[model samples]
Target: MKYILFIIITLTAIFSFSQDKEKEALLAAKKANNYVYEGNNLINEDDFVSAEKEYRKAISEQGTTVAGIYNLGNSYIKKGSYEEALYRLDQAAKIATSKVEKHKAYHNIGNVLMENKKCKEAVEAYKNALRNDPSDEETRYNLGLAKICAEQQKDKEDDKKDDKDKDKKDDKKDQEKKEGDDKKDQDQKDKGDQDKKEGDDKKDDKGKPKDEKNDKGKGDEKEKQQPPQPRPGQMSPQQVKSLLEAMNNQEQKVQEKVNAEKQKGYKIKTEKDW
Candidate 1:
């Protein structure tokens, strides 16, 4: 009988402990819900700072409170803190226990991505939202807009690439043309210098052309073979002839005197002959 009483006492202690734990859990859940309700009222009043505090309190009271996380994310969106909003919304979506909760979180995540100009990611996010709640017309509409934005962004990038390519091609052509012009100018300058050097080689000391000087020498030889022409400072051919005749007469007189001296020397020879 004492053993049975001991067993009953042990069972009662265990049940009491279990019941106490259940009551504590219920109390915490009630506190968490109260904080979430207070945060909602603050959000409606446009008091985001106070609402954020209340939401944080709800999350601290009950770590599994989806409403606390989701509302906190929405508050971040209102504050334009998109990165924070995305983080909280993503957490809420992962921990969501229902499709309705998941749809709300994904839809807001799409909104944040769209605000940040992430159209491609936003389109995927909206698509996920629709997967959870196919009846949501708003998510479908946002998905369409995101698709259009993504295409426009892609086309803009393509146009920029094309413009860059065209600019590069034009630059290359300009550089080639500049190089060709430089080469042509150098060639013309070199040719001009070569022609000048050849011209200098064909000249004489007197600055006269060598070919003209040679032709002048040939003309001088031809003049020597032709009859002489009289000039103002020179004797004529007729005067030269007169001067030669005078010289001949003087020589003949001298020869006659020499013969007279020979006849005088011959008198002695005639007497010897008699």
Candidate 2:
């Protein structure tokens, strides 16, 4: 009965092991210490897909060992998964047991954040790396350089955005001004036409012809705008003749109006007007 129980338990364990057979095999390789180097070799060869798979296998076998996690994060970084790199680097940092491991995780996190343009956050990460191991002059110098580049890029982008906004506002204002000018010009033209029409109405009520009224108005406007005459005696012969002809025409018009009133059965009260 004891032998049968042992055999049964052995079979169950085999079955469970078989279910995670691939993971167990990868773990065996990781325990040999060469899988990390092999994964890094694949990364150096630019075989990112294979490198990613190898790093993932390594991490699964090694759990959250700082070196494994950091290398996994680097593999993801090579694959352009910056967000995933950040998360893996974070895990590496938490599990780090030594200054070297801790600083490495911090630097990697900073690098990924810098790539993602979370500049302020990256600066903090780099600072944390420096605090862990201030002897890494290369990292400190890189941090300073990255900060300068990030700030310059941000300033350039902001300036471009501001210029674009200003240009848009100026364009809108110009368009509005053009529209206003058009409306104002249209209104002025309409008003001038309306005044001309009103003048025509007054002329029609006085029974004056358009040509006559226009000529008379032009002459009166000219006279008003001209310098004053020396005296009535200074009038030219042509001007005096024109004035006498106009008076004669007015006298004939008065007589014709009197005759028209008589024909309509209305007697004139005085002959002086006729």
Best by lDDT: 1
Deviation in Å, model 2, residue 36 alpha carbon: 3.2
Please write out the lDDT profile of model 2 over residues 89-160, one tens digit for every residue: 899898888988889899888888887877778888989999899999877986997788779878989999
RMSD of each: 15.6, 18.5
Candidate 1 — which pairs collide?
A: none
Worst 10 residues of 1 by lDDT: 265-274
In order, the Cα lDDT scores of the candidates are 0.94, 0.83
Candidate 2 lDDT at 26 equals: 63
| Candidate 2 stretches greater than 4 Å from native | 1-37, 44-47, 79-84, 94-98, 113-121, 203-274
